[model samples]
Target: MCSHYEPVITKKQLATHFKVADLEDGLKPELWPGYIGPFIRKHEYADVGDDAVPFRELMVGSFGMIPHWSKDTKIARMTYNARSETVAEKPSFRDAWRLNRHCIIPAQAIFEPDWSTGKAVPTRIVRTDGKPMGIAGIWTGWKNPANGEILRSFSMLTVNADDHEFMRNFHKPQDEKRMVVILQEEDYDGWLSATWQDSRQYLKQFPAELMQTQTEAWTTDLP
Candidate 1:
């Protein structure tokens, strides 16, 4: 599961890369400065509607998921990734999978592990061509009953790891599958379309050669 990710790029860089010329017009620009984190925030994306109508709502979202019907907040802490195989049936993700799907999780790289030696070893998986990788995602809004706080969050969708050499060792023994569904630039329209069936049909694996992998430094310091 993709429980860990890193968005090391600056907000300015991300805006340019995503072809979003009007950051202030669409989202709160002031929020961008403090959004850098181990987990990317939802304030970073441009909400282009199904018709590709650009809206001013913040598009970036937390990696974990918060079901629309959830009664508590702790569930989100454990729902960072959703398996594509069972997403349509899972209670926590089914509604969002069928309705409120989203896009644009701007990321340079993600961390995964190989536990072959009985000791987990970390590896940084990045785009082989040095381009940013965008993972297909789903989002939802949850209102906290205690304080009436509304939290918008999302989860990355994972599929079977095929020939992606870089991701071959990321999964645990119980689940050999390891990969995030990556939509190509041309397929972006199909993915974000309002037609749920069309969107699901367009979801496909990115080329394995598109990724580059390397061992990451082990650190105990908090970010």
Candidate 2:
């Protein structure tokens, strides 16, 4: 599960990359579950039909899956990471997937645990080429009937990484290996435009050779 990540780029830079209009400033440099982060989705317009306008827009959304029917925000923590194999069928993600509510999560690095040293050790992973990565995700919009407030949240999709030499090195030994689906530059627009059936084809592991990892040991002594 990709619970933590760093967004090294500014919203202005992201807006430029995605060719979108101006963005909301003050985006966080790092984010965790329940924290707001940048996400890209099709612009919503009342009069626009499916093909009327194809402008992609950026928004600041919280990380987690708050199903529209959810009564409260309690379920978000558990829905932060949705398994790719079952995403299309899972109750929490099914509706969004069926509606093509796909999104892209930009991140410079992700934190995970390394167990190669016989203990759970913290490590940060990044692209070897130093380019930012766009993780495949699905988002949901939940409304609070009491005050008519809406909460837009998302979940990162993960695929089996047991066979991935580098990715398999993280997480607990007993837990099944998994990794977030990072899309290539050429597939960005296609991923968002793809239907549920076509989207399934992008849920694959990124090449381990193009990734790099740095580990830091935990110390018992306090400063």
Candidate 3:
């Protein structure tokens, strides 16, 4: 599962990449489960027909998902990643999946542990061609009962990567290998518009040849 990532771009750049309007805020270079980050989704616009250009909106959303039925935000920590194989059947993600609430989590690169070394080392993985990735995700909104304020959050979907040449290197040797579903540029709209039944087709692993990894020595040092 993807737990750490970096978005090395300005709000304007992010908005431009998604062909959305300018955003007023930017995300931290590094983001964790509770941190807020940018996500793109279609928005309904008045006087716009379905055949017209789709209205896309780039907004900041909490990284972890807080289910609507949850009494508190504690669940967000464990809900950061939803497995693609059973997302539609999992209690935490089924509702959103059934409702087709999809979003795109864009990032410049992601961090994973490289276990080839004697000790686990933090390594950054990015596209060999230096393009950003748009990871597939599902989102939901929960209302803060006290203030009646809505908190939106999302979770990245992951698929088994044990057979993947590059992805199988991460995580502990005893643990099951998994990787986030990184959608291709041509499939972005299809993923976002897919029905629950069609969503499964987009959960396949990304090409390993287009990916590259780097380990920063300082990142593995003890605090």
Candidate 4:
């Protein structure tokens, strides 16, 4: 499972990298080392109707998911990563996977587990070209009943780690499943296209050669 990860880039840096005109007002630019800061995303938009909307109004959501059907928000703790293989059929993810398939989680880098030695170790993975990476994601809005508070949350899609060398080590030797769906720039338009079929076609594995990994220091705090 991808219960822990990183998106250390600042909002300002992400704006310049993705060329977006503005970042949400409350967002900070400091690098996030752990769960303390918001996840910074680039090159993706919030799905609204027939077009993709800019990220100006959307706040950085916690990576875990809080489904609309839940009675309380605690379910989000286990919904952080949705399996792409069963997304179309799973009870918690099917509806959103079909109609609410939206957004992209941008990150300067992500950490995945490597348990080949019987204990888990975190490996920092990044684009081989040093560019930021985009992970396929889905978002939803939850309303607080008592206070009328609205919260937008998201989760990253995961698939079998067939071609990614760095990702292979993260999955169970028998399971071979991995979180973090990196998208290619060439396929960005298709992945975020209004048509679902067009987006599905672009959900294949990103080029393995474009990714590189190295063991990095681990911390429980976000910068």
lDDT of each candidate versus the true structure = 0.62, 0.81, 0.82, 0.61
1-223 per-residue lDDT for model 1 (tens digits)? 5655665346575655554333332332111112322222223244533545443233444457778788876676677678878888888888887774655565677777777887767667788777776677777778888899887777778877755565766667666767888667565545555455656665567787787785667543323
For 114-154, candidate 2 gives per-residue lDDT tens digits of 88788966678999987888899999898988899888999
lDDT (Cα, tens digit) per residue for candidate 3, span 1-223: 9888875357565765666655555557777787777777766461277656656667677788888998877777788899998998888899999998888888889988878776777789998887888899999988888898988889999999999999999999988999999999888888877888888899999998978896554332221
Ranking by TM-score: 3, 2, 4, 1
What's the residue-level lDDT of 30 in candidate 3? 79
TM-score of each: 0.77, 0.88, 0.91, 0.78
Deviation in Å, model 3, residue 130 alpha carbon: 0.4
Most TM-score-accurate candidate: 3
Runs of candidate 1 with Cα error greater than 4 angstroms are 21-57, 219-223
Query: Model 3, 182: alpha-carbon shift in Å?
Result: 0.5
